[model samples]
Target: MKRAGPWLRVVAGSASFALPTILGIVILNFLFLQLLPGDAVDVLAMRSGSATVESISALRVQTGLDQPLSGQLAAYLSRLAHFDLGVSTQYHLPVADIIAARLPDTLLLVGGALGLAVVLGLLLGSVMASLAGRWIDRMLSGLLMLIYSTPGFWIGLMMILLFSVKLGLFPSAGSATIGTRLSGLAALYDKAAHLIMPMTALSLFYTAVYARLVRATMIDVLRQDFILAARAKGLHPVTLIRRHAIRNALIPVVTVAGIHLGNLLGGAVVVETVFGWPGMGRLAFDALLSRDFPVLLGVLLLSSILVVAVNALADVLLGWLDPRILTE
Candidate 1:
C-alpha cells in the first residue's frame, strides 16, 4: 500500500497534465478547421441545385456557424465539458456515435499491427545483435532499411494488388465482408482474412523501426560494464543476454514505441484509405473531404487523448522498469 501511493500520485499528476493539453488540442483543432476555406454551408450550397444566398445564410444560422468565433469556441468548450462532441454536419449524426461506430475497427487494426511489430522486431533485432557484422545481419539490415523507407500506402496497394487481385488469397479492402452473416469461428475467420493485408502494411515500417532500435540498444547494452561483469561471472550466453542485455535494451524500445503511437495512428489514414478499411482514419478522411468540422474535431480530440494515454502508459512503464525514474 505504501509503495502504491507514489504510483497513484504519478497517475494523478499525469491525468491533471493531460486535461489542459487536451483542451489546448481541442481549441487548436477548432481554430484550424475554422481557418479552412469552406464550411458545411458552402458544401451544401455547392451540392444543392438552387441554393440561394438567403438559403445559405439561413443554413449557417441554423447550424450555429453564424456565431462569432469566440462564441463558437465557448460553446465548443462547454460541449466538451459535458462530453458532447457535437453533431456532424456531413452525416447529421452525433460525432461521438460516428466515432464509436468506427473506433473498434481502428483499435483492432492498430492493436494487431502493434503486437505483430513488437514480436517480430524483438526476435529479429535479437538475432541481428547476436550476429552483428555477419552476412545475415547485413542482409536483414538492408531489407529492413528498404521497408522502413517505403511508404505505407504504397506497400498496402502493392499487397492488395498481389494478394487480392492476382493471388486472390485475401480481401483487398475493408474490415469484413459486406453482407454475409456468419456465426462463431466463421465470422472470426472472415474478419481475420480481411485484416491480414492492412495489418501487414501497417506493421511493416514499424517492425523495421523497432528492429533497428532494439538491435542498436542491445548492442550498446552488450558493451556495458555491467554486461561485461556478468559475462566474466561465467553466466551462460542465453541467460546473460536475456537477463542483462535484453532487459536494459527494452527500455528505449518501449519509449520509442510509445512515442510513435501517434505516427502509427496517422499512418493508418493512408493505409485505411488504400485498403478501404472503415476505421477512424477513413472516417476522418471522409470528414475532411466533406468539411465536416464536427467529425474532424472529434477525431482529432480522440486521437490526442489516445496519444496522451499511450505516452502516460509509457512513462509509467518506464518508472516501473527503472525505479529511479519515479524519484525524478
Candidate 2:
C-alpha cells in the first residue's frame, strides 16, 4: 500500500496532462484538415462526373461547407463540446458510430503487435546479451538489423504473397473471414488466423528495435557494480541476468514502448490498407481520400486520446517498476 502512493501520483499527473494534449491534437487535426485543397463536395463532384453548379451549391450549403472557415471551426467545436462528432459527409452516418465500429479492430491489431514485439524482443535481447561476442549473437544482430531497415508495408505484402498465395496458410487481407457467421472459439480462431500476417509484419520492425535496445541496456546493466557484487557472491549467471539485469534494463524498453504505441497507429494506416482490415487507420485513409473531414477528425481525435491513455498507463507501470522515478 505504501509503495502504491507514488504510482497513484504518477497516474494522476498523467491524467492531468492528457486532457490538454488531446485537446491540442484535436484542434491541430481540424486546422490541418481545413488546409487541404478541397472538401468532400469536391470529391463528390469528381466522382459523379457531372454535378450542376446549383446542386453543388445546395450540397455545400446543406452540409455547412458554405459557411466561413471560422464559422465551421466554431460549429465543430460546439458539436464537440456537446459530445457529438458530427456525421460523415461521405458515408452519411454519425462519425462516432463509424469510428466506434472500427476502433476495436484497430485496438486488437495494435495490442497484438505490441505484445508480440515486447515478448519476442525481450527473448531475443536476452539471448544476444547472454551470448555476447558469440556467433549466434552476431548472426541474430545482422538479421534483426535487416528487418529493422525494411519497409513495413513491403514486408506485409511479401508475407501475404508467401503465406496466403504460395502456402495457402492464412487469409491474404482482412480482419476476419468475410461472409461467415461462425461464433465462439471458431470465430476467434478465424480472426486470429487473419491477424497473423499483419500482426507479424507490423511488429517485426519494432521487435528488432526493442531487441537492440534491450540487448545494449542489458549488457550495460550486467557490467554494473551491483551485478559484479552479485556475481562475486556466487549468483548463477542465469539468475543474475533474469532477476537483476533484465529488470533494470526493462525500464528503458517500457519507456520506449510507450512512445512507440502512438507510432503504431501511423504504421497501421499502411498495414490496414495492405491487409484490408476494417480499422480506424483504414477509415482515416479512406476519409482522407474522400475529403471526409468529419470522419478523419474523429479518427484523429480518438486515436490521440488512446495514445494519451496508453502513455498514462505506461507512466503508472514505470512508477511501479521504479518508484524512485516518481520522487525524481
Candidate 3:
C-alpha cells in the first residue's frame, strides 16, 4: 500500500491536468491558426486542383469552414470528444493514423537523444563537482554556458556541413530509406550510425545542462550532515561520492531530467527541421505550413499531454524520494 502511494498521486494529478491541458492546447492552436496570414480556407485554396474564391468558400463550408468561432469550437470539441480528431483536410487522411505511424519514430529519436544527453550530463557533472573551483571547473562552466547559449539547430547545421557535406561521411538528412536493409547486428549499427550527429548535438547541449544541475546538486548533497558522517567513517572518496553523494544528488537531477525529456519532445522543432527526421516536431511544422489543423492539433495535444504527464510523474517521484517534501 505504501509503495502505491506515488502512483496513485500521479494518476490523480494527471486526471486533474486533463481539462486544463486540453483547453490550453485548444486555445493555443486556435490562437496561432487565427493569427496566421490566412486561415484554412485560403491555405486549402492554394493547394486546390482549381483555385477560386467560390471554390474555396464551398470547400470551406464542406470542411466546417463556414461556422462561427463558437460553433467551430463546439464542433471541434465534439469531434475530439469522440476520439475523432477529424481528417487532415490537406493530407486527406485521419489524424490518428498519421500520429500512430509517426509517433514511434519521434519517441525513438527523442528517447535515444535524451538517454545520451543524461549519461554525458551526469558524468560531466560529477567531474565538474569533483573539480569545483579549479581551472578545469571554470573551463567546464564556460563550456556549459556556451552550450546553453548555442541553439540546437545551429549545432545541427554545423554538424551536417562538416560531417555530411564536407567530409562526406554520412547522409545529410532523413531517418532511413524504405530499401535500407535491417537484419540484426547490421541494422543496429546502421541505425546507431545514422543517429550519431543528431544524438551528439543533443547530448552535448544537454550535457552542459545536466552537468550544471548535477554540480549544483552534488555540491549541496556533499555538504549534508550524512555525507559528512560518511566521510568521517574513512569512506573512500569515490565510494563516498558515488554511494552517498551521487545517489542523493540524483533526486534533483531526476526532476530536471524528466522536465528535460518533456522539453525535448516539445522542443525538437528546430532539430527535426534541420534533419528532416520526420518526428512529430517536423510533422507539426509541415502541418503548420500547410494549415493542416487536425494534424497540428493532434501533435500539439500529444506534446502537451506528454509534458504534463511526465512532470506529474516527476513530482510524485520527488515527493516519494524526499519524504520531507510530503510531510511539509
Candidate 4:
C-alpha cells in the first residue's frame, strides 16, 4: 500500500490535467468545425433539391442553427455539462447512442493493433539486439525500414489482394459477415477473422517503429554500467537481458506509445475506410461528408476522452515500471 502512493498521485495528477485539457479540446473542436462553410441545414437543403427559404429557416431554427455562434457554443457547453451529446441531424438518433454502437468496434481495432505491435516489436527488437551485427539483424533492419517507409493503406490493400482475393483465407472487408447470426465461439472466431487484416495493416508501421526503437534502446542499455554489473554477478544471459536491459529499455517505448496513441487513432480513419470496419473513424467520415455536426463533435469529444484516459493509464504504468518516475 505504501508503494502505491506514487501511482495514486500520478492518477490524481492525470485526472486534474485531463479535465481542463478535454474541455479545451471540446471548445477548440467546436470552434474549428464551425469554420467549415456549410452545416447540416445546407447539406439537407442540397440533398432535398427543392428546399425553400422559409423551410430552410424553419429547419435552422429547429436545429438551433439560427442561434448566434455564442449562443450555440453556450448551448453546446450546457449540453456537455449534462453529458448529452445531442442528436445527429442526419440520423435523427441521439449522438451518444450512435457513438456507443460504433465505439466498441474502434476500441477493438485500436487495442488489437496496439497489442500486436507491442508484442511483435518487443520480440523482434530483442532478437535484433541479441543478434546485432549478424546477417539476420541486417535483413530484419532492412525489412523494418521498408515497412516504415511504405504507406499503411497500400499495405492494407496489398494484404487484401493476397490474403483475401488470392488465397481467400480472410475476408477482405466488413467487421462481420451480414445475414448470419453466429453466436458463442463461432461469433468470436468470425470477428477475429474479419479483424486480422485491418489489425495487421494498422499495426505494421508502429511495429517497425517500436522494433527499431527497442533495438536501439536495448543495445544502449546493454552497454550501461548496471548491465555490466549484472554481467559481473554472473547472471544468466537471458535473465540479464530480460530483467535489466529490456526492462530499462521499455521506459522510452512506453513513453513513445503514449504519445503515439493519438496518431494510432488518426491512422484508424484510413485503415477503417480501407477495411470497411464499422468504427468511429468510419462514422466520423460519414458525418463529415453529410455535415452532421452533432455526430462529428460527439465522436471527436469521445475520442479525446479516450486518448486522455489511455495516456493517464500509460503514466500509471510508467510509474509502476520505474519508481524513480514517481519520485520525480
Best by lDDT: 4
lDDT winner between 3 and 4, please give it: 4
Estimated TM-score per prediction? 0.96, 0.97, 0.90, 0.97
Stretches > 4 Å off in candidate 1: none
Task: State residue 186's C-alpha deviation in candidate 1, in Å.
Answer: 1.5
lDDT per residue as tens, model 1, 264-324: 8999999999999999999998888888888999999999999999888988888887887
Winner by TM-score between candidate 4 and candidate 3 = 4
TM-score of 3: 0.90
Ranking by lDDT: 4, 2, 1, 3
Q: What is the lDDT of residue 104 in candidate 1?
A: 94
Instruction: For candidate 2, write residues 148-237 as lDDT tens digits.
Output: 999999999899889999999999988887788999999999999989998998999999999999999999988899999999999999
Relative to the true structure, candidate 1 has a C-alpha RMSD (angstroms) of 1.4
User: In terms of TM-score, which candidate is stronger, 1 or 4?
Assistant: 4
lDDT tens per residue, model 3, 1-328:
8866656766677678876876877777766676677766777676665798788778888888688877987888888879887898777889999998889778778878877877777788888887899999999899889989998888999999999999988777777645877878877776666777776776677778888988998988888898889889899878888777776666877788787876787667777778777789888888888878888888888777777776777777777677665543
Q: Rank by TM-score, highest first.
A: 4, 2, 1, 3
Alpha-carbon deviation at 175 in model 2, angstroms: 1.5
Q: Which candidate has the highest TM-score of all?
A: 4
Provide the lowest-lDDT 10-residue window in model 3.
Answer: 319-328
Clashes of each: 0, 0, 0, 0
Cα error of candidate 2 at position 58, Å:
1.3
